[model samples]
Target: MADPVAAVAALDEPNRRKLYDLVARATCPISKDEAAAAVDLPRTTAAFHLDKLVEMGLLTVVHERRTGRSGPGAGRPAKLYRRSDEQIAVSLPDRRYEAASHLVTDALVEAEQTGEPARVILNRRAYEWGADLAGQAAEADASRGPASNRVTEALARFGFEPLAEGGSILLRNCPFHSLAHRHTELVCGMNLCLISGLLDGIEASGVTAHLDPSPGHCCVRISQAPSSRSPSVSR
Candidate 1:
Protein backbone atom coordinates (compact mmCIF):
# COMPACT_ATOMS: atom_id res chain seq x y z
CA MET A 1 0.00 0.00 0.00
CA ALA A 2 1.11 3.58 -0.56
CA ASP A 3 2.79 5.09 2.46
CA PRO A 4 0.79 8.06 3.72
CA VAL A 5 3.93 9.65 5.05
CA ALA A 6 5.79 9.11 1.81
CA ALA A 7 2.89 10.35 -0.28
CA VAL A 8 2.68 13.44 1.90
CA ALA A 9 6.41 13.98 1.54
CA ALA A 10 6.13 13.75 -2.23
CA LEU A 11 3.83 16.75 -2.28
CA ASP A 12 5.10 20.33 -2.00
CA GLU A 13 6.01 21.53 1.51
CA PRO A 14 3.00 23.57 2.65
CA ASN A 15 0.64 21.43 0.64
CA ARG A 16 1.97 18.34 2.40
CA ARG A 17 1.23 19.87 5.78
CA LYS A 18 -2.17 20.97 4.57
CA LEU A 19 -2.98 17.49 3.32
CA TYR A 20 -1.93 15.93 6.60
CA ASP A 21 -4.13 18.34 8.51
CA LEU A 22 -7.05 17.66 6.18
CA VAL A 23 -6.67 13.90 6.58
CA ALA A 24 -6.44 14.27 10.33
CA ARG A 25 -9.60 16.36 10.71
CA ALA A 26 -11.88 14.90 8.10
CA THR A 27 -13.87 11.95 9.43
CA CYS A 28 -15.49 11.12 6.13
CA PRO A 29 -14.81 11.60 2.43
CA ILE A 30 -14.79 15.06 0.88
CA SER A 31 -15.18 16.44 -2.65
CA LYS A 32 -12.46 18.15 -4.66
CA ASP A 33 -13.82 21.61 -3.96
CA GLU A 34 -14.32 20.92 -0.26
CA ALA A 35 -10.88 19.35 -0.01
CA ALA A 36 -9.44 22.44 -1.71
CA ALA A 37 -11.27 24.64 0.75
CA ALA A 38 -10.15 22.44 3.62
CA VAL A 39 -6.51 22.97 2.61
CA ASP A 40 -7.13 26.64 1.73
CA LEU A 41 -5.82 26.05 -1.81
CA PRO A 42 -7.22 27.72 -4.89
CA ARG A 43 -9.89 25.72 -6.72
CA THR A 44 -7.67 24.71 -9.66
CA THR A 45 -4.76 23.88 -7.42
CA ALA A 46 -6.92 21.90 -5.03
CA ALA A 47 -8.42 19.98 -7.92
CA PHE A 48 -4.99 19.08 -9.26
CA HIS A 49 -3.71 17.86 -5.90
CA LEU A 50 -6.93 16.07 -5.07
CA ASP A 51 -6.53 13.92 -8.18
CA LYS A 52 -2.93 13.35 -7.25
CA LEU A 53 -3.94 12.21 -3.79
CA VAL A 54 -6.50 9.87 -5.31
CA GLU A 55 -3.94 8.48 -7.72
CA MET A 56 -1.60 7.87 -4.81
CA GLY A 57 -4.47 6.06 -3.07
CA LEU A 58 -3.84 8.41 -0.16
CA LEU A 59 -7.47 9.50 -0.55
CA THR A 60 -10.54 8.19 -2.31
CA VAL A 61 -13.92 9.67 -3.15
CA VAL A 62 -16.31 8.18 -0.62
CA HIS A 63 -19.64 9.76 -1.39
CA GLU A 64 -21.31 12.46 -3.43
CA ARG A 65 -24.25 14.58 -2.25
CA ARG A 66 -26.34 17.54 -3.34
CA THR A 67 -25.45 21.15 -2.58
CA GLY A 68 -28.21 23.73 -2.50
CA ARG A 69 -29.37 25.01 -5.89
CA SER A 70 -27.59 28.12 -7.20
CA GLY A 71 -30.91 29.52 -8.56
CA PRO A 72 -34.65 28.98 -7.98
CA GLY A 73 -34.42 25.78 -10.06
CA ALA A 74 -30.75 25.10 -10.64
CA GLY A 75 -29.10 22.10 -12.35
CA ARG A 76 -27.86 18.97 -10.59
CA PRO A 77 -26.34 19.31 -7.13
CA ALA A 78 -22.61 19.86 -6.62
CA LYS A 79 -20.29 16.89 -6.10
CA LEU A 80 -18.82 16.28 -2.66
CA TYR A 81 -15.42 14.70 -1.85
CA ARG A 82 -14.17 12.90 1.22
CA ARG A 83 -11.23 10.99 2.72
CA SER A 84 -10.91 7.22 2.63
CA ASP A 85 -9.67 4.91 5.33
CA GLU A 86 -7.26 3.61 2.70
CA GLN A 87 -5.23 6.82 2.88
CA ILE A 88 -1.47 6.48 3.21
CA ALA A 89 0.10 4.91 6.30
CA VAL A 90 2.32 7.53 7.85
CA SER A 91 5.07 6.19 10.09
CA LEU A 92 8.51 6.95 11.50
CA PRO A 93 10.53 4.68 9.24
CA ASP A 94 13.69 6.66 9.93
CA ARG A 95 15.74 6.74 13.14
CA ARG A 96 14.07 9.85 14.49
CA TYR A 97 12.86 8.11 17.64
CA GLU A 98 16.24 6.51 18.26
CA ALA A 99 17.96 9.86 17.88
CA ALA A 100 15.57 11.51 20.30
CA SER A 101 15.97 8.68 22.77
CA HIS A 102 19.73 9.10 22.54
CA LEU A 103 19.50 12.80 23.25
CA VAL A 104 17.68 12.19 26.51
CA THR A 105 19.94 9.25 27.26
CA ASP A 106 23.09 11.31 26.71
CA ALA A 107 21.80 14.04 28.97
CA LEU A 108 21.89 11.46 31.75
CA VAL A 109 25.46 10.52 30.82
CA GLU A 110 26.71 14.11 30.89
CA ALA A 111 25.37 14.79 34.39
CA GLU A 112 27.33 11.87 35.90
CA GLN A 113 30.61 12.89 34.20
CA THR A 114 30.63 16.64 34.87
CA GLY A 115 27.90 17.85 37.20
CA GLU A 116 27.75 17.77 41.05
CA PRO A 117 27.58 14.64 43.18
CA ALA A 118 23.99 13.76 42.22
CA ARG A 119 24.08 15.53 38.82
CA VAL A 120 24.31 12.36 36.72
CA ILE A 121 20.74 11.47 37.52
CA LEU A 122 18.83 14.37 36.05
CA ASN A 123 16.20 13.12 33.60
CA ARG A 124 15.74 9.79 35.35
CA ARG A 125 15.28 11.67 38.57
CA ALA A 126 12.85 13.99 36.90
CA TYR A 127 10.81 11.06 35.60
CA GLU A 128 10.79 9.54 39.04
CA TRP A 129 9.88 12.83 40.62
CA GLY A 130 7.11 13.28 38.09
CA ALA A 131 5.96 9.70 38.68
CA ASP A 132 5.90 10.25 42.41
CA LEU A 133 3.76 13.29 41.91
CA ALA A 134 1.37 11.25 39.78
CA GLY A 135 1.11 8.53 42.41
CA GLN A 136 0.28 10.97 45.17
CA ALA A 137 -2.46 12.60 43.12
CA ALA A 138 -4.00 9.19 42.47
CA GLU A 139 -4.34 8.63 46.18
CA ALA A 140 -5.43 12.17 46.96
CA ASP A 141 -8.73 13.52 48.18
CA ALA A 142 -9.75 14.41 44.64
CA SER A 143 -13.38 14.30 43.59
CA ARG A 144 -15.19 14.43 40.28
CA GLY A 145 -18.89 14.08 39.61
CA PRO A 146 -19.27 11.51 36.82
CA ALA A 147 -21.93 13.60 35.18
CA SER A 148 -19.71 16.64 35.39
CA ASN A 149 -17.63 17.80 32.44
CA ARG A 150 -14.59 15.69 33.34
CA VAL A 151 -12.48 16.10 30.23
CA THR A 152 -12.95 19.82 29.73
CA GLU A 153 -10.90 20.50 32.89
CA ALA A 154 -8.29 17.71 32.54
CA LEU A 155 -7.37 18.67 28.96
CA ALA A 156 -7.13 22.35 29.80
CA ARG A 157 -4.02 21.62 31.85
CA PHE A 158 -2.42 19.44 29.11
CA GLY A 159 -2.79 22.43 26.72
CA PHE A 160 -4.78 20.47 24.18
CA GLU A 161 -7.84 21.76 22.44
CA PRO A 162 -9.86 19.07 24.21
CA LEU A 163 -12.71 17.33 22.51
CA ALA A 164 -15.37 15.67 24.65
CA GLU A 165 -17.51 12.78 23.53
CA GLY A 166 -19.80 10.62 25.67
CA GLY A 167 -17.67 10.81 28.85
CA SER A 168 -14.36 10.63 26.97
CA ILE A 169 -11.94 13.38 26.03
CA LEU A 170 -9.73 13.15 22.94
CA LEU A 171 -6.42 15.00 22.78
CA ARG A 172 -6.31 16.24 19.21
CA ASN A 173 -2.89 17.83 19.33
CA CYS A 174 -0.82 14.62 19.41
CA PRO A 175 -0.92 13.32 15.88
CA PHE A 176 0.81 10.10 16.89
CA HIS A 177 1.01 7.96 20.02
CA SER A 178 4.80 7.90 20.23
CA LEU A 179 5.44 6.74 23.81
CA ALA A 180 2.92 3.92 23.83
CA HIS A 181 4.21 2.41 20.61
CA ARG A 182 7.46 1.44 22.31
CA HIS A 183 5.83 -0.41 25.19
CA THR A 184 2.16 -0.21 26.07
CA GLU A 185 2.19 -1.33 29.69
CA LEU A 186 5.42 0.48 30.52
CA VAL A 187 4.15 3.80 29.27
CA CYS A 188 0.76 3.24 30.87
CA GLY A 189 2.47 2.43 34.15
CA MET A 190 4.63 5.51 33.83
CA ASN A 191 1.56 7.59 33.17
CA LEU A 192 -0.32 5.98 36.02
CA CYS A 193 2.62 6.26 38.36
CA LEU A 194 3.17 9.92 37.62
CA ILE A 195 -0.50 10.77 37.66
CA SER A 196 -1.02 8.87 40.89
CA GLY A 197 1.65 10.83 42.68
CA LEU A 198 0.16 13.97 41.28
CA LEU A 199 -3.18 12.99 42.83
CA ASP A 200 -4.06 12.25 46.50
CA GLY A 201 -4.05 8.70 47.95
CA ILE A 202 -1.68 6.62 45.86
CA GLU A 203 2.03 6.37 46.63
CA ALA A 204 4.80 4.99 44.41
CA SER A 205 4.22 1.26 44.10
CA GLY A 206 7.30 0.82 41.87
CA VAL A 207 5.23 -1.56 39.85
CA THR A 208 7.05 -3.29 36.98
CA ALA A 209 4.73 -3.44 34.03
CA HIS A 210 4.53 -5.77 31.01
CA LEU A 211 3.78 -3.94 27.79
CA ASP A 212 3.06 -4.71 24.12
CA PRO A 213 4.74 -2.67 21.44
CA SER A 214 2.15 -1.32 19.05
CA PRO A 215 3.91 1.47 17.19
CA GLY A 216 1.09 3.80 16.35
CA HIS A 217 -0.79 5.89 18.86
CA CYS A 218 -0.68 5.62 22.60
CA CYS A 219 -3.66 6.68 24.65
CA VAL A 220 -3.28 8.65 27.84
CA ARG A 221 -6.37 8.23 29.91
CA ILE A 222 -7.07 11.10 32.31
CA SER A 223 -9.69 10.52 34.96
CA GLN A 224 -10.37 11.49 38.53
CA ALA A 225 -8.98 9.12 41.11
CA PRO A 226 -11.32 6.43 42.28
CA SER A 227 -13.39 8.00 45.04
CA SER A 228 -13.30 6.86 48.66
CA ARG A 229 -17.05 6.51 48.32
CA SER A 230 -16.46 3.49 46.07
CA PRO A 231 -15.38 0.13 47.45
CA SER A 232 -11.67 0.20 48.13
CA VAL A 233 -9.03 -2.16 46.79
CA SER A 234 -5.50 -2.97 48.01
CA ARG A 235 -2.98 -0.46 46.68
Candidate 2:
Protein backbone atom coordinates (compact mmCIF):
# COMPACT_ATOMS: atom_id res chain seq x y z
CA MET A 1 0.00 0.00 0.00
CA ALA A 2 2.81 2.37 0.84
CA ASP A 3 5.33 3.54 -1.73
CA PRO A 4 7.86 0.73 -2.13
CA VAL A 5 10.45 3.18 -3.38
CA ALA A 6 9.92 5.29 -0.29
CA ALA A 7 10.27 2.20 1.86
CA VAL A 8 13.48 1.26 0.03
CA ALA A 9 14.67 4.83 0.57
CA ALA A 10 13.91 4.56 4.26
CA LEU A 11 16.66 1.98 4.35
CA ASP A 12 20.41 2.65 4.60
CA GLU A 13 22.47 2.63 1.37
CA PRO A 14 23.90 -0.86 1.67
CA ASN A 15 20.49 -2.10 2.76
CA ARG A 16 18.78 -0.30 -0.11
CA ARG A 17 21.19 -1.75 -2.66
CA LYS A 18 20.54 -5.12 -1.07
CA LEU A 19 16.79 -4.83 -1.75
CA TYR A 20 17.13 -3.63 -5.32
CA ASP A 21 19.71 -6.28 -5.81
CA LEU A 22 17.08 -8.87 -4.91
CA VAL A 23 14.33 -7.65 -7.28
CA ALA A 24 16.87 -7.07 -9.98
CA ARG A 25 18.25 -10.60 -9.88
CA ALA A 26 15.13 -12.61 -9.04
CA THR A 27 14.54 -15.17 -11.78
CA CYS A 28 11.68 -17.28 -10.41
CA PRO A 29 11.47 -15.61 -7.00
CA ILE A 30 13.83 -16.46 -4.16
CA SER A 31 14.10 -17.74 -0.58
CA LYS A 32 15.96 -16.17 2.37
CA ASP A 33 19.23 -17.97 1.76
CA GLU A 34 18.93 -17.09 -1.91
CA ALA A 35 18.48 -13.42 -1.13
CA ALA A 36 21.37 -13.59 1.32
CA ALA A 37 23.58 -15.23 -1.29
CA ALA A 38 22.57 -12.54 -3.75
CA VAL A 39 24.17 -9.84 -1.64
CA ASP A 40 26.93 -11.96 -0.13
CA LEU A 41 25.81 -10.96 3.40
CA PRO A 42 26.04 -13.11 6.46
CA ARG A 43 23.02 -15.24 7.34
CA THR A 44 22.19 -13.12 10.38
CA THR A 45 22.69 -9.90 8.43
CA ALA A 46 20.59 -11.22 5.60
CA ALA A 47 17.85 -12.22 8.01
CA PHE A 48 17.96 -8.79 9.57
CA HIS A 49 17.72 -7.10 6.19
CA LEU A 50 14.96 -9.46 5.13
CA ASP A 51 13.00 -8.69 8.26
CA LYS A 52 13.13 -5.03 7.36
CA LEU A 53 11.98 -5.86 3.84
CA VAL A 54 9.12 -7.94 5.20
CA GLU A 55 8.07 -5.14 7.53
CA MET A 56 8.02 -2.74 4.59
CA GLY A 57 5.78 -5.25 2.73
CA LEU A 58 8.35 -5.84 -0.01
CA LEU A 59 8.62 -9.47 1.10
CA THR A 60 6.42 -12.00 2.83
CA VAL A 61 7.26 -15.28 4.43
CA VAL A 62 5.83 -18.01 2.29
CA HIS A 63 6.46 -21.02 4.52
CA GLU A 64 8.42 -21.90 7.63
CA ARG A 65 10.31 -24.96 8.82
CA ARG A 66 12.77 -25.74 11.61
CA THR A 67 16.53 -26.28 11.25
CA GLY A 68 18.91 -27.45 13.94
CA ARG A 69 21.74 -29.91 14.61
CA SER A 70 21.11 -33.55 13.72
CA GLY A 71 23.97 -35.36 15.54
CA PRO A 72 22.05 -36.78 18.48
CA GLY A 73 18.66 -35.61 17.21
CA ALA A 74 17.66 -33.59 14.12
CA GLY A 75 15.18 -30.73 14.22
CA ARG A 76 12.69 -29.55 11.61
CA PRO A 77 13.66 -27.60 8.46
CA ALA A 78 14.44 -23.87 8.41
CA LYS A 79 12.03 -21.18 7.19
CA LEU A 80 12.65 -19.58 3.80
CA TYR A 81 11.87 -16.06 2.51
CA ARG A 82 10.14 -15.12 -0.70
CA ARG A 83 8.93 -11.92 -2.32
CA SER A 84 5.31 -10.85 -2.12
CA ASP A 85 3.31 -10.48 -5.32
CA GLU A 86 2.77 -6.83 -4.47
CA GLN A 87 5.24 -4.27 -5.83
CA ILE A 88 5.74 -0.52 -5.61
CA ALA A 89 8.13 1.34 -7.87
CA VAL A 90 9.94 4.65 -8.15
CA SER A 91 10.30 6.93 -11.17
CA LEU A 92 13.60 7.19 -12.98
CA PRO A 93 15.27 10.57 -13.45
CA ASP A 94 14.19 12.08 -16.76
CA ARG A 95 16.94 14.68 -16.73
CA ARG A 96 19.48 11.92 -17.24
CA TYR A 97 17.81 10.58 -20.38
CA GLU A 98 17.09 14.03 -21.67
CA ALA A 99 20.72 14.97 -21.26
CA ALA A 100 22.04 11.93 -23.10
CA SER A 101 19.44 12.29 -25.80
CA HIS A 102 20.57 15.88 -26.06
CA LEU A 103 24.09 14.81 -26.90
CA VAL A 104 23.12 12.37 -29.65
CA THR A 105 20.37 14.59 -30.97
CA ASP A 106 22.75 17.51 -30.98
CA ALA A 107 25.05 15.47 -33.16
CA LEU A 108 22.17 14.62 -35.45
CA VAL A 109 21.12 18.27 -35.68
CA GLU A 110 24.66 19.30 -36.38
CA ALA A 111 24.96 16.58 -39.00
CA GLU A 112 21.92 17.97 -40.75
CA GLN A 113 23.27 21.54 -40.67
CA THR A 114 26.53 20.39 -42.20
CA GLY A 115 24.56 18.22 -44.66
CA GLU A 116 26.15 14.93 -43.47
CA PRO A 117 24.27 11.93 -44.76
CA ALA A 118 21.88 10.58 -42.08
CA ARG A 119 22.30 6.82 -42.59
CA VAL A 120 26.04 7.25 -42.54
CA ILE A 121 25.81 9.00 -39.19
CA LEU A 122 23.59 6.32 -37.65
CA ASN A 123 25.73 3.44 -38.94
CA ARG A 124 28.80 5.24 -37.70
CA ARG A 125 27.40 5.06 -34.16
CA ALA A 126 26.49 1.39 -34.39
CA TYR A 127 29.95 0.60 -35.74
CA GLU A 128 31.72 2.73 -33.18
CA TRP A 129 29.94 0.69 -30.51
CA GLY A 130 30.51 -2.60 -32.33
CA ALA A 131 32.06 -4.34 -29.35
CA ASP A 132 29.18 -3.30 -27.18
CA LEU A 133 26.71 -4.72 -29.67
CA ALA A 134 28.71 -7.94 -29.93
CA GLY A 135 28.56 -8.42 -26.18
CA GLN A 136 24.81 -7.85 -26.22
CA ALA A 137 24.37 -10.32 -29.04
CA ALA A 138 26.07 -12.95 -26.90
CA GLU A 139 23.70 -12.15 -24.02
CA ALA A 140 20.65 -12.35 -26.26
CA ASP A 141 21.68 -15.81 -27.33
CA ALA A 142 20.85 -16.95 -23.80
CA SER A 143 17.20 -15.82 -23.56
CA ARG A 144 13.77 -16.41 -25.05
CA GLY A 145 10.68 -14.28 -25.90
CA PRO A 146 10.65 -11.44 -28.41
CA ALA A 147 13.75 -9.53 -29.36
CA SER A 148 12.76 -7.14 -26.56
CA ASN A 149 14.73 -9.20 -24.08
CA ARG A 150 17.88 -8.81 -26.14
CA VAL A 151 16.99 -5.18 -26.75
CA THR A 152 16.72 -4.60 -23.03
CA GLU A 153 19.94 -6.49 -22.42
CA ALA A 154 21.75 -4.54 -25.11
CA LEU A 155 20.43 -1.30 -23.68
CA ALA A 156 21.68 -2.43 -20.30
CA ARG A 157 25.06 -3.05 -21.86
CA PHE A 158 24.88 0.53 -23.11
CA GLY A 159 24.14 1.63 -19.48
CA PHE A 160 20.34 1.98 -19.52
CA GLU A 161 18.29 -0.10 -17.14
CA PRO A 162 15.08 -1.46 -18.67
CA LEU A 163 12.18 -3.13 -16.86
CA ALA A 164 9.88 -5.59 -18.59
CA GLU A 165 6.17 -4.78 -18.45
CA GLY A 166 2.98 -5.77 -20.31
CA GLY A 167 3.95 -6.32 -23.96
CA SER A 168 6.05 -3.17 -23.63
CA ILE A 169 9.20 -2.55 -21.62
CA LEU A 170 10.08 0.36 -19.35
CA LEU A 171 13.41 2.09 -19.81
CA ARG A 172 14.57 3.06 -16.32
CA ASN A 173 17.51 4.77 -17.89
CA CYS A 174 17.54 6.86 -21.05
CA PRO A 175 20.85 7.69 -22.65
CA PHE A 176 19.08 10.32 -24.75
CA HIS A 177 16.24 12.96 -24.63
CA SER A 178 17.71 16.29 -23.43
CA LEU A 179 17.43 18.37 -26.60
CA ALA A 180 13.64 18.59 -26.27
CA HIS A 181 13.59 22.36 -26.07
CA ARG A 182 15.67 22.76 -29.21
CA HIS A 183 15.57 19.59 -31.33
CA THR A 184 12.15 18.42 -30.20
CA GLU A 185 10.81 16.80 -33.34
CA LEU A 186 14.02 15.37 -34.77
CA VAL A 187 15.53 14.06 -31.55
CA CYS A 188 12.32 12.55 -30.17
CA GLY A 189 11.33 11.07 -33.49
CA MET A 190 14.83 9.80 -34.01
CA ASN A 191 14.78 7.92 -30.69
CA LEU A 192 11.35 6.53 -31.46
CA CYS A 193 12.31 5.30 -34.91
CA LEU A 194 15.57 4.02 -33.55
CA ILE A 195 13.87 1.84 -30.98
CA SER A 196 11.29 0.74 -33.50
CA GLY A 197 14.02 -0.35 -35.88
CA LEU A 198 15.85 -2.09 -33.09
CA LEU A 199 12.70 -4.07 -32.38
CA ASP A 200 12.19 -4.80 -36.03
CA GLY A 201 15.76 -5.96 -36.43
CA ILE A 202 15.30 -8.24 -33.47
CA GLU A 203 12.38 -9.83 -35.42
CA ALA A 204 9.82 -8.06 -33.25
CA SER A 205 8.01 -6.77 -36.28
CA GLY A 206 4.96 -4.54 -35.96
CA VAL A 207 6.48 -2.92 -32.92
CA THR A 208 6.31 0.85 -33.12
CA ALA A 209 8.30 2.80 -30.60
CA HIS A 210 6.82 5.85 -28.93
CA LEU A 211 7.68 8.32 -26.19
CA ASP A 212 4.97 8.88 -23.58
CA PRO A 213 5.47 12.16 -21.72
CA SER A 214 2.63 11.61 -19.27
CA PRO A 215 4.24 8.71 -17.40
CA GLY A 216 7.68 9.59 -18.69
CA HIS A 217 8.21 6.25 -20.44
CA CYS A 218 9.53 5.12 -23.79
CA CYS A 219 8.55 1.72 -25.23
CA VAL A 220 7.61 -0.34 -28.23
CA ARG A 221 3.99 -0.37 -29.35
CA ILE A 222 3.35 -3.36 -31.64
CA SER A 223 0.77 -2.52 -34.28
CA GLN A 224 0.19 -2.92 -37.99
CA ALA A 225 1.47 -0.07 -40.09
CA PRO A 226 1.01 1.18 -43.64
CA SER A 227 2.55 -1.00 -46.34
CA SER A 228 5.54 1.28 -46.73
CA ARG A 229 7.96 1.83 -43.83
CA SER A 230 11.28 3.57 -43.77
CA PRO A 231 14.36 1.44 -43.06
CA SER A 232 16.29 4.17 -41.30
CA VAL A 233 17.20 3.29 -37.66
CA SER A 234 17.41 5.67 -34.72
CA ARG A 235 18.40 6.23 -31.04
- Highest TM-score against the true fold, candidate: 2
User: How high is the CA lDDT of each candidate model?
Assistant: 0.45, 0.55
Residue 19 of candidate 1: its Cα lDDT?
Answer: 67
Clashes of 2: 10
**Model 1 spans > 4 angstroms off:** 3-5, 67-78, 90-235
**Residue 223 of model 2, lDDT score:** 36
Report, for all candidates in order, the number of backbone clashes: 38, 10
lDDT of 2 by residue, 1-235 (tens): 5565667675666864675467546654456677777778777777777777777776666543344355555655555556666766554552344334444665677688888765456544433343344455656576645555566665565444667667555666544545544666554555555555455445544444455543454432333434324344432
Best by lDDT: 2
The residue-by-residue lDDT of candidate 1 on 43-157, one tens digit each, is 8887776666666666665443365447666665555445546634444432234333543466557667777433223324334544454444334426643323333443333
Give me the displacement of residue 78 in model 2, in angstroms: 56
Q: Give me the runs in candidate 2 sitting further than 4 Å from their true place.
A: 1-135, 139-148, 219-235
